[model samples]
Target chain A: MSYALSTLWFERQRYLPAVLAVAFSCLLIALQCGLLLGLFSITSIPIDESSADIWVAHPDVPSVDLGIPIPEAWQSYLAVPEIAHTEPYIEGFAYWKKPTGGTELVLIIGARLGPDSIGAIRQLTPELRMLLSETSSAVIDEGEFTRLGIEKVGDTAEILGKRVRIVGTVSGLRSLAGPYLFCSLDTARKFLNPPPGQCTFILGKCHDKEDAPKVVERLKAHPRKLYPFTTQDFSFHSQMHWLTKTKAGIALGLAAALGLLVGAVVTSQTLYSATVASLKEYAVLRALGIPRWRMAMMVVSQAFWVGIAGIAFAIPTIFGIAFVGAEVGAKIMLPYWLLIFATSITLVMAMLSGLFALRSLRMVEPVTLLR
Target chain B: MRADGLPLTPSMKAWGLTRSYGSGDTKTYALRNVSLEIYPGQIALLMGPSGSGKSTLLAVLSGLLHPDAGTVLTLDKDLWAMNERQREAFRLEHFGFIFQGYNLFPALTAREQLEMILKWGTGCSARDATARTSDVLTMLGMSKKAHLRPMQLSGGEKQRVAIGRALIKQPNFVFADEPTAALDWKQGQHVIELLRAAAHDQGSTILVVAHDARIIPFVDRVLHLEDGILYEGEERPMELYGGPTAPSPGYIAQ
Candidate 1:
């Protein structure tokens, strides 16, 4: 080991608090960044789960929420040379009457009972799909059974003043707003009372996924009151709609950034104080004729070791938090891109704090050793 | 006294060394019009009471501190004429220092302490430095305790290790600030004798600053400082048992 490294070992007590501070900062940073990424991921789920390439919605509808339902005749879009097929889906929000007679808020969605239907419900097994073809049949996520007071698949509930029966349960479908209750288009139209022969979205399959841009352009040129978006384009716009127009999205994003900012400040202050305390040792080296750069390398070495150790500690901690979040139907997803980004941010923060700590080293004069 | 022995060539010389802290009426002078010459192959003692600028003079002469208005020369190279980088290189090439409290690195074992100095002062590889460290430690009577850290060693052992650090590079000169202050009489005398032998054997100039007169019977020349100025008293070499056993290594007859 270099003298720089050995010095840290000798002074471990003097440097322990700073090391832990950086570790805690890493945890908070990963937590916030991971949460933001997960939020963005789930926002795209409605788009990602779809097999269709083209989505038609209200010209200004940025998110999944429906605008005034449009006429269902948009199926004529399939007749376009670039288009293959189309399906209409209904989406809205309503109150769910619990068994206790109290109402809870819910997002309600409806689509045709076919594999080619417009919604992204993974729970619609062949059996469930046949069952959902019957009116008054619906499905709810299995994870929320306790929260909703439902004991089994045959449990009944009331949505929008219409009696509904849960026929099946699905996994991996969750929303931050509340639980989702999926039913048929006919049932949705009869209960929520949207205009007859109308749907909030028109999903279109393209002959070739690559040709979607051309299809969207052609559909746009033909005079129709609807907007055309590739599934990706629609997903992005939907997420942006929520992010730009709603306070919840903006607040969560700010909170994530705030966590990173606060972590850096706390860790930087702690490391800076530790560097100040070691100035005397640094001065002794300087007086002994060690170069100023060598002394700086000493401080940088300490910071580097601290950063590595902090990251080691933060990985398991963040994984535990994510696991706990999953149990409550809240997902704290950490995709590979987020992991790489967080790791880079961690090293930069550590190096920046190291540089900040160097500010105190400049004050260490060789003359201090004389005293 | 000089007729008996005075160097025709000196290792270091300073003229009008003046240093002060603060400014305006509140300013206090640590050194004023101080001038002196240091000779080779001899341990010289500097004595003074508190706040008399004994340590300040040592700092200025050794290139550890810059005087407000003065000039210092070692081996005829102007210590202040060079920039900070050059001054640093000059100190590494020419000077070694032992502080009163032993100022040894608390983390480094006894051998590693000397190895740190040897490697940095000479640009040698760690293996080579470690090799030399064992030889240097043995020379200082510290071979058995080379692996112990400063805190694990006693006061005298620490002082001897400090002396070993000063001697490792065979520097052009060594400045020790109160080398014997922390030791008892026997340890103090032993440390002084070690420094004396190193000076006699290596021909390196050694200057020690202290207030303890108990160390006086062991040095070659004694100088007194009172209020930032040297007393310029008569120069006399201390009587010794059979005199300096070995001729100074780099000495030329005057």
Candidate 2:
């Protein structure tokens, strides 16, 4: 074996407690961040899934939680010379009859199946177009189906007192605020109501993304008297609205911050304790002519092992929790970048603790070996 | 006569070495103006009572502890003038220490312990390091127990392993602090013989701070210490008879 590997192996048994602590701490942090990311994903599903480059809503629609009515004819108005396509979208919550003959709440979304349909919900599945074409068809996510005790694909669900046949299942496509049910505009209008010309919002797609802001400004100035926004602006406003107005969103943010802080402190303390415990060994090494930098490398190596082991132990458990959370109608999305960021944070915390432990190492006098 | 002078070549010399602990009225003088010389190829013992500065002198001589006021020259190099880093490297390159407790690294086997010294000494490849370790273990008659860790070995075996560590590096000098204190009479005699042979055959200077009378007979000269001053004694030849010798009456009195 190489010198480093051999020495590390000899010292490995003494560092078991520190390693276990690191693993458990990493697991805690990963699960916390994963669940939080999952929650954020659920809340932003409509915005994330929408194909619209611009959105037109009421001047103060607030968030996905609130709905504002606009003229459905605005779709034709937005389909101008510069605009490629436009569609009117209906979004609202309604009670649906469960497969078990009970009732559950879900967010209902309406969009046409055509060249101007925008395909926001269709992004959830390839079969969405086929399902929406059925006129009486509706698509519900797996999380909603599982919670409502619905197993078979053809099961019928009663929304707003009208029965709609389930034509397909969409996975991980639930709305941030509630379980989502996607259907044709006709079915949505029939259930949600004031006839053919009324809709909740207008979604417009442009030929060039750079033209989105100009298009939104033009639509806002139209005599139809509507509030319009670029998709990015609308998404940002939606997130901010939820963050400031909803108790669940605020609580989740607080919990995530607290979890990060506690994780850092706990990991640092554990690593520092391990260093102190091994102070004598470090002194012996110093007396044997090992430099301070080599001693630091050994400590850093220990920290690295801890961080890696902790992340490894945590990943599966986070996925399992996310699956369960999804079933309960909470959107738990695990983003790749977020996982990488959390691992980096864990390494930084471990290194910080190592710095503290180095103080104890420096205090060791080689002459103590004589005593 | 120049204190067994024979034209001292200053292989290891201390001048006006003094070390004191505490301050002012409460001060304790561990060593006061102590000076001595140990020539190469000599096994010298520092004999003293408790608190007589034997350990302090050894610490200074080995570059482990700096003296309050003195210059310790080993092979004409001033020890105290070197910085901590330099002193540590110097000690590793030129000095080998064997303490009373054997101080063997608990995680290492007998062979590994000796190999650690050789690796540091020669910076050689593993194959060469192993060869040197085996050679040294054979010389110390510890080849059979080379695979055993300190915890698995008897006190005598552990001390023998320590001797192997000290001698494996082939340093210019070796400092031993009560090396045979933990061993029985036969084992103690064996350790003293090993030290004597290391000096005679390897031409290395050996200095030991010991109160054990069992080791006195094996030393080439015993320097008696009353307070911290060295009082030179007559040179004595080592008596390596087979059986255990009874403890000295003076030690029994203490």
Give one digit per residue, the lDDT tens place, for model 2 in A105-200.
Answer: 777788766644673554645567766777768887866667656876788867777777888877867565557778777777777774567788
In model 1, pairs of residues that clash are none
> Which prediction has the highest TM-score against the true structure?
1
What are the per-residue Cα lDDT tens digits for candidate 1 across A188-257?
A: 7766778877888888877788999888887788777558889888876776666556565667656656
Clash count list over all predictions: 0, 5
Give the best candidate by DockQ: 1
In terms of lDDT, the poorest run of 10 residues in model 1 chain B is B244-253
* Segments in model 1 whose C-alpha atoms lie over 4 Å from true places: A2-5, A33-112, A115-120, A135-174, A177-266, A269-273, A327-330, B1-7, B20-32, B115-124, B232-254
Off by over 4 Å in 2: A1-14, A44-108, A114-281, A315-338, B1-8, B111-131, B141-147, B234-254
True contacts kept of each: 0.54, 0.23
Poorest 10 consecutive residues of model 2 chain A by lDDT? A1-10
